[model samples]
Target: MATTKSSSYHHGDLRHAVLTAALEVIATEGPGALSLRDLARRAGVSHAAPAHHFKDRTGLLTAIAAEGFDLLADALADAPDLRERGVRYVRFGVEHPAHFQVMFLPDLLRGDDAALLAARARAGGELRAGVTGMPEGGRGDDARLAGIAAWSLAHGFATLLLSENLREPVGERDPEEIFRALAELLF
Candidate 1:
């Protein structure tokens, strides 16, 4: 059963509905296909409703990126080690492809949104925290480099897996299992 525009929605429900519809649009068609009018139609609201909530397309994308980073932070929070964190990162990317796509593309979002910046910082902090071998004093340049390498590895692998670029080599194996093997080799 799909939620329709005629469905009675409370104060905040419409905003949530619009965001949900936008994510669906991104998932099925890609972010390039996203439009406030289309999302309004999908959410059973007037074409202007999305604009009222988001102000503009960039506003909507900023919200999505912020939400995505928050979700990523939560997903990575419980991992016990660098390898497990990398596994979680890959899993998050696979599970939330739409969010993953929007979260990283700076050109599509309002980079100065305070909430978005905070959320992104939190996610970055989590990623850095995963590099447990850092020296005790403070995260030196080496730790920063190591974190970047780990993030690149997980993000690259996840992107390749999602695009089916690695299908031949990864056939029949769960992405997480493959990620774990790779993580062990690297970290």
Candidate 2:
């Protein structure tokens, strides 16, 4: 574990550390437990230090959500196919349990910030564009719907898994197979 004293307060990465610590708080204690002061303390910075990077709690959360979307976009981009993107999203949610929890639970974070909204839109656009580029259909509403459907399915599956709602034996089948099965059953 990296000691707080070893971390540079004046370094360019302090903001990132604060955000990362805030995420840890959110994951372990729920978003309600997250606070600028607490994050600063955890990062071994003064209480007022977070204020230098984030105007308030909202700013901090907005940054976290933006970071989440950027990561999601990258994960989606790396997938080889539409189905693979869905699998990748599920994988990302599982791997980034903290970000995934806060990103979807809008009640846990500030969802009203303009910057956050723009970042979310950019991520959404990236997902939609990836789907639109697929050979399955032409770009536009159809492709957008495909993107939405894919995202919804993956998100729902991930949420269910996190909540332990899907107790069925989902072994060896892989996420793609499960996704296809769900799509066939629902849509």
Q: After TM-score superposition, what is the CA distance of residue 181 in candidate 2 from its true location, in Å?
A: 5.1
Compute the lDDT for candidate 2: 0.74
- Encode model 1's per-residue lDDT on 1-187: one tens digit a residue: 2358766244457888888888888888999998998888877778898898799889998999999999999999967878888899999998999899999999999999998999999998888888854454433557767788889999999999888899999999888999999977766
- Each candidate: what lDDT? 0.86, 0.74
lDDT of 2 by residue, 1-187 (tens): 2228346475567787888788777777877787888787788888998899888887777778878887888887755656667777788887887788777767656777776787788778766765766776343457667777767888989888766676576765665578767755643
Clashing residue pairs found in predicted model 2: none
Query: Could you say which candidate leads in TM-score?
Result: 1
Query: How many clashing residue pairs are found in candidate 1?
Result: 1
